[model samples]
Target chain A: MTNEKNKKVVIVDYAMGNIFSVKLACQKVGICAIVSNDKKEISNASALILPGVGAFADAMATLEKLDLVRTIKEFIASGRPFLGICLGMQLLMSESEEFGLHKGLDIIKGRVVKFPAVNDKVPQVGWNQITKPSYSNINWEETLLKGLSEKDFMYFVHSFYVLPNNNNIVVSETNYAGLNYCSSLREKNIYACQFHPEKSGESGLLIYRNFYNLINK
Target chain B: MKNIRIIPRLDIKGPNLVKGIHLEGLRVLGSPEDFAEHYYNAGADELIYMDVVASLYGRNGLMDIIEKTAKKIFIPLTVGGGLRTLEDIKNVLRAGADKVSLNTIAIKNPNIILEASRRFGSSTIVVSIEAIKQNDGKYMAFIENARESTGVEVFSWAKKVEELGAGEILLTSVNNEGTGSGYDIELTRKVSELVSIPVIANGGAGELEDVVNVIKQGKADAVSLASMVHYDYVKKSMVNGSLLKNQAEGNIDFLKFGKISEKIETSGIEEIKFYLKDKGINCRK
Candidate 1:
């Protein structure tokens, strides 16, 4: 991996996400990240990171109002490294059923749904372990799951889980009170996860390092 | 299974970190950022900075402290005390607080909770209820750092706050606070059961057993501690009104507030987590 100086990563600011922590995480890994709502800065980024926290419908509305929908699509189509975290990841789905039926960015073939009321809490707050598949067509070892194990814990605080249309895109899964759900997904240059790697301590910092390495390569 | 959150709650008075017995007779500890750094290194799951005098003093003074600490501490930080408006919430969030806990303003204007939650996510908003056990054996909510009683029942208020879109409920027992007695198990259990959102039991935690009891028996998703962790590291730190006089006399420099000593023999968060884990509590190792 190249330790390129002044490597710029753009965090798409639609005015909803936890952009502070994400930018700090990038700084921890020696990458300079700029949180920009401007389309030009986003399109010109070496790598794009979309970090979001809040309701899915409200986020979509902000993105629509800011007119970032097409710019994001074209950036992803360019095959540059891109990452979506938490609500940012949820917005990649075709639609979400949070509160009511609302549309998403549709970068990935999936729909966001609320966690089933199965005797457990609605929002699975706190640290939970992620399980990787034994075998898969995608190189799980080479992707964002690099240098990590199944027992590694990630911080998650959300009531909804994603159901992707294709299983091949799923890189890992986590089980919450007997209900297994998709935790991380990857499609070509795009990467997304339901968990917050920025808030997950040292193990989390490794994921950002891996992403930086991928972009640098 | 979800891991239980272990939070070190630091009560701040202006720049110095202070703790009181049942929220009175405030004693000055050193800088909050120092204690925050110590806790972060000790493997604390999260940290809470409560401006104890914010409501009474009419200003939240932890913005600069939070901004400095958030740069170093990567864990989630929840800031509470005197957050009365949407602009206040926005300012705290901009200063790098992961979540803002509302107590006085939430009870005064319930719409602030709705508006804050609507603007920021529900997860970013927490309703901190200071509960005191009444003579009839039921808990009543208090405000202004447990000085005034709202007379609203704990269970009903918790449900209402959840309905108002609070992501979590921080239930503190004023009767049990700083006394090292124990957390109010019955109150925590009732509030936790009444709401689908997470409930954090704060106030009294003297021993590992107190932490275990609150989570295992009381069903608290998280625990916020002050005296349990604070007293462990400082010597003769408990102040009874006279320290405030010394502070006001300009004889005491808060930077060199108290002598450092280890009163509690445990190895901090690691030991606590290990003790809890041995007792079959699933905590993050």
Candidate 2:
């Protein structure tokens, strides 16, 4: 609103946490981001960020209470830009098993689950590489992975993920147990990732930058 | 292609990072936020915060710390320790932590991992396994070291973790803890072969050579080290040298773990090292 040339990208902070980083990340890309739990602020914004950092079910409850689920869906449907991070990303799915049968935004026909514990250790902590050459094209289209390469590394810290019922939603993938699992996902106007672009350093910032650019129009 | 991961681990207690020898009597080392920012700048792909005092506190106080660090550090931060149930995982995730890691509880109820993954998807759940080579020379599961034996083969249980919907494995070797003898290559190798998910090798990493050796022998996707990397004890030059040697020999490829660009050269490694150090991160050296 202040700078006509600057795009307005509102970070939908429903007390879901990670509001600050998501906001800062967007700012790094020169996007004028306003962190708000307000529906009006969200509705007026050219772009929306549903930043989430908690359980899938609880996050959904919060979104529902804020009457954001419908608004978010409307934005996506209207071809406006939207991005979901971590738990926010998980909520875009149909449902998650976090607290027993919790429903999701259902924009993408998928489910979220906790990371399985192999005999080794649970919570595959720390940095690991993500790869699957075939997914390079669709994934690159995702603003979150912009300015990165096919083998580019993004930071991850999740116990659950979005399982696209439709593989076309899978933009990029990273292997964990020799199996290629969807990492970043895209569907028309909406985008999401199981990994955190906020914490992925420069590459992560680029993702925010690209997502921000989507709203410039 | 095997993805290569370099992770830095931080054991947090009350917003501060405390690294102890063998997960006991943690000493106040530095700020978790600063350390995380440092590592993120140091080319560390992801960082883990193990709540070493979850048992004493009766809960995982990861949210406050997670939100604090996530604000300053833009990379992924994982929280583990003292998780009682799936609800606990939700609480931490709500608190701004990226993922929830469960260990002791997973041993008590493996279905928790299965249930969470079945509903939420598998990539979010991480199961940490504490393995000890028993007197019989066979690996057995432990919660906080060999305190309570699960009487299960480490590698066998690793397979179970994957089946239960775990996204990745955090493998720590009790025999290697505090010893600085390098990683438990055999344990890493065995688990790597057992599960197809990414495996993170923790517990013992004395130097840059140890880091390279662990990934090479174990075929692990990532190497997670705490004190060695966090305290600046491991020299950045060594890490650069090691990575260069590995790359030159074709021992590893850049894209295995996801590189923004594979522009790193044996010679360029030094330049990147300086970039990281200038950013105030604690590296392997």
Q: lDDT values of the candidates? A: 0.84, 0.69
Best by lDDT: 1
CAPRI level of candidate 2? incorrect
The runs of at least 3 residues in candidate 1 whose Cα sits more than 4 Å from the true structure, single-residue gaps closed, are A1-4, A134-140, B56-61, B235-267
Task: For candidate 2, give the DockQ.
Answer: 0.22
Q: Report each candidate's C-alpha RMSD, comma-separated, in the order given.
A: 4.0, 10.6
For candidate 2, lDDT tens digit of each residue in B1-285? 233556778887765566655565455554566667767666666679888767776453457677667666666567898888777876776566666678889998899998776544566577898888878778888885346777778878999999878888889897776456778999889998888777888977765566667766777767787766654622333344332332322212221332211211121223333533455432322
- The interface RMSD value for candidate 2 stands at 6.2
How do the residues B115-192 of candidate 1 rate in per-residue lDDT, one tens digit apiece?
Answer: 988888899999999999988898889999889988788899999999999999999999888777889999999999
Q: Provide the lowest-lDDT 10-residue window in model 1 chain B.
A: B258-267
Q: Report how far residue B108 has shifted in candidate 1, in Å.
A: 0.6
Query: Which residue runs does candidate 2 get wrong by more than 4 Å?
Result: A1-45, A49-79, A83-152, A155-196, A213-217, B58-62, B233-285
TM-scores of the candidates in the order shown: 0.92, 0.65
Candidate 1, CAPRI quality class derived from DockQ: medium
What is the Cα-based TM-score of model 2? 0.65
lDDT of 1 by residue, A58-118 (tens): 8999999999999999999999999999998999999999999998998898899988787
